[model samples]
Target: MAGRFFSVFSRSLNQPFRSRLQGLMNYGLSCCVNALLQSFSATWELVDLLDRWNPVDKYKESVPLQLRKVLLAMQSDQSQPAPHQDFLHCLDRNYIRLHVQQDAVEVFLSILNLIQQQMSDKALAQEIQSLYKVTVETYLQCLECTYIESGTSFLLSLPMHIKESHNSLEDCIRLFFELQELRDRDNCYCERCGEKKPSKQRFRNSRGYTRKLHCKVTFPETLNISEILTAEALSQSYVQSDSQYSLCAVIVHSGDAMFGHYTAYVRHKKDQSWYYADDSNVRQVSWEEVQNTYGGSEREGTAYMLLYRRTPEGKQQEWSSG
Candidate 1:
């Protein structure tokens, strides 16, 4: 019966049997990686960049190399059931353990970091890193003498702390940029004053563009930076144009922080349609159904990591039903 079905299916060229969405088999406890792979698949730019890499002989077990292979196979029309097993094994050889629960955010960052460390092409390596790099300035201001010390740093992902009560993504982001007063035991040693003094620790300047929110924060399907930016942030040198971002992918956790399963809802780039991908099972979904992930109730999944893409100015955002 299976052979007859394949024969008939192959013969119907006019009605081609092409799958719009493909699934990856769950090997051991690999749902987390599977979810990430769906998001990575949605990001075609990353895939194209990875395709250009030509690594030397030393780094054969490179994560990016195996990842490129797996992504290509997953997108192909092959008959293989488990195309990602070898990629999973490669990650295991790199010390990302199999059969163990993993944090989606940490694993995602680890994969990018591995690409940075293992890729032989230095120029292409930095290009991949710049895709998600967020630059910010940290400053320490002394209260007694009005002295300030500042430094700049970059983050691959912005980690925001969530409140126990209801929280919005914009509020969480605004609070992350807010200045905090440090007093008493938290005072810093002043160089000119030569003693411990009260001060303020705050982010001075930030080049906020595309960002990843790492918390149980509820964000809208479309996010505008017009309201989220504070007066101080607006006055900074890096703040240029207010950009609008659309939610492209979400990494969801079903259980508690300690034990959970990972899945993803990724929006297609060409069609702008939503698709839910659980390990080895992929299905088309609606925008309203995607909203069901907004946490605040029981038995529903919370968003662990969010992926947003900046919408180009003057272009209409088209979201069509699949």
Candidate 2:
């Protein structure tokens, strides 16, 4: 009897509320009602004030120079707390603004000078380097996303502190070069389709026991391998009359130490990976050995070499040079 009475009382309380909720939802006024109901709370009032005065950008652009000067000073002296109170008050709104301000030559120079004053603190220099890289990457990404062309060259222009104990901005720049290349190579083309070689058609060829592929870019050399083999291997099972030649070149991708070891075969004309030449013998092997084993005579040009490799998932990949 008590259970039945409670069920009836519950339905009595919920039915009208349920009806009102259904009506509000059907009319698409639920959200408006919710906002009005939430207005009773302080949090909602704060949000309302923020919405009414979206002045974040204004605050950034209007930062007092006196405070900035103090920051520069503190940044220079590691013994001092970098004045965070005034800055942190505007934290969420002013971060982007502060970052942009820091990009200014004057601002950066001030900070740089401050950092120079604390040159004895190797840890501090390393910290600054990390911050510098993060800033550059963040700026680069934002520019790329926004399609802003101007700041793209800023990375090449920024002066950074070099420390013997830490990897500097130069190292990051080199890595960026290699990464930029891989990004450039994200597209692929099928070699079977050809009509005068598309100005950049790719091809595949075999050299000795290895296969190679390449982009049909011209190189600066040629050779006759079998004619010189007696001077090389002493006997000729490994050397064949029709043995194909491969040539490779070292291209420093992005003006960094990371070089593209390009190798490709001349006869069948395919691209290859660098793994074939990455050997103790191969490294010790001279250009003469390269010529005698794979090179063959051509009228006035040099034969190319290509290298091939198996990828982590068992796919074939190739890289070429010279």
Candidate 3:
């Protein structure tokens, strides 16, 4: 029966078998292509509407009217075509665009606030943190853009410079101390005069030693070396001291550099003013031998390597974990 039916149907078509098969395939492909085109047209229309819609006025007024028009157009009458889906899609696109613009505005305001230090001034270091927060939010907005990965990473890294700037300064100071050369000379004092002339004392730490003679008991306003020659002189004076090298490292928690606490290492030498130790020529010696022997005992800690640098204004501060 099936064979007979196929014979009759084939005769009725009045076309070759391959031609009929090709015709069916072409019809199916056309349907698929048409569906794809319709969907794309719908999406493009939505994008166009979002691009033109004004959230503050035009769009707000048009949305309700558009929805009502779409519903009314869906009447049983065959003459008018209803665009219910397109109207809804347009509404959603407008909302998403508005949200994106709002986020961008918020991020821009935050950047300005940081410039003004409104996050709270130097009395507390909250400003750095607030600025960092603003930076992160900006990065999130970029994630919604086209060039996501690199753009986001670049923005995120901008705030990280605050940490790097602090770290670089500490490293430079440590290097200077490690390469500092101190001048040593003997002192003769009159014991008879309770006008007792003060003896020279050398204080050694990571950088070099401070020599305080009877004449001057305080640090100089600036480091005594000239920039160009200082490096060379420091190279000649680089002595590996067994005295524990004191360095400063900033502690950052939750993307914030904690400036409230500080750590320092101190060393004491016989010549209290400033002079090099005898066996300071080797690199990486035991902690006890080169450790800043004077002040570390006063502070409580598991004793880690310390890095120190002058503050921004070149002021010397005795940083306490306090």
Candidate 4:
């Protein structure tokens, strides 16, 4: 069944797929959510999981229920223009207001949290949650003593802080895992020292698996992390088959930090091609077009959130089978 679906999906990509692709109506400044929905549609794994959910009642008020409906409607051959109005209303009812500028990364995290909170099926909810979970172990070493504190936590999307100057996706990712010195006023409280003292903080991958990072920093189309991650970090994880990742989706923000519009460039999974989606219009694009979002220029759209998939090990597979 999966193979058949991929075959059809691939054919659609090669054809006038944009004509069949439905666009969301921007009701009261809904471009942010609309852009996100485009990326969500591209993430077929998420859509498949959402399809398995069966909500008995209270569907109108449930975020996941509304999301599932909207995604399905968007992919359908129906003539309805504004299919995501209910999903937007559902979000508004859940306190994510409309007619306001939103940060894409924050909205993405909120959607994941909503799914974890509102989904009725426990196992399915967990499956959805695990789809983007990034597990890391944070270590805090006391400077005064040798006492070290470690804790394991999970992030649905890793947030990388960006610098003012030019930066690469690989640098930002490595910086996220790099150790930092916390000294003077920024000291941590040490139980052994019974006082605040200088310390070092670092994080490493906890287990072997593929994870997602919604890089807040601007990133190029192709990202190679072979030289970024330290050997120690890679040696600790068995899932580190390859250190290369291809851009699957890019959530773009245009204008200043205070006010902006959001759009997305999503790559079709089966065909490995790019498409740009802005509110109600989507068009086929190339790799050069995707690089335009790297953002070092003025009055141009900048990449606000990035969605990358690990490159598969075998030459025949474009992406990981999982």
List the global CA lDDT of all models. Answer: 0.72, 0.24, 0.23, 0.72
TM-score of 2: 0.18
Query: Pairs clashing in candidate 1?
Result: none
> Each prediction's Cα RMSD?
8.0, 30.8, 33.7, 6.4
Q: In candidate 3, what are the lDDT values of residues 1-322, reduced to their tens digit? A: 0000000012334643221000101121122211111221212222233234333333432443343333333222222222444443443443422212122222323323332332123322242223223111111112112121112111211211111112332233334233222233322233343222323221123333422111111111123223312342233333323112212221111111211112212221111111111111112223343223212222322111211222223333332212
Best by lDDT: 1
- Model 2 / residue 31 / CA error / Å: 39
Model 4 gets an lDDT of 0.72
lDDT of 2 by residue, 84-197 (tens): 334323322333232221112233334334333333444544443332232222111111222211122212123322222333222422333321211233322223332112
Candidate 1 colliding pairs, count:
0
| Candidate 4 Cα outliers beyond 4 Å, as residue runs | 1-20, 77-82, 203-226, 242-244, 315-322
* Runs in model 2 lying further than 4 Å from the true structure: 1-67, 72-82, 95-152, 156-172, 179-185, 188-322
C-alpha TM-score for every candidate: 0.85, 0.18, 0.14, 0.85
lDDT tens readout by residue for model 1, 43-132? 666767877777675444778888888776665555444388878988999988899988888898899899898887889989887767
Steric collisions counted per model:
0, 38, 26, 0
**Candidate numbers, best TM-score first, in rank order:** 4, 1, 2, 3
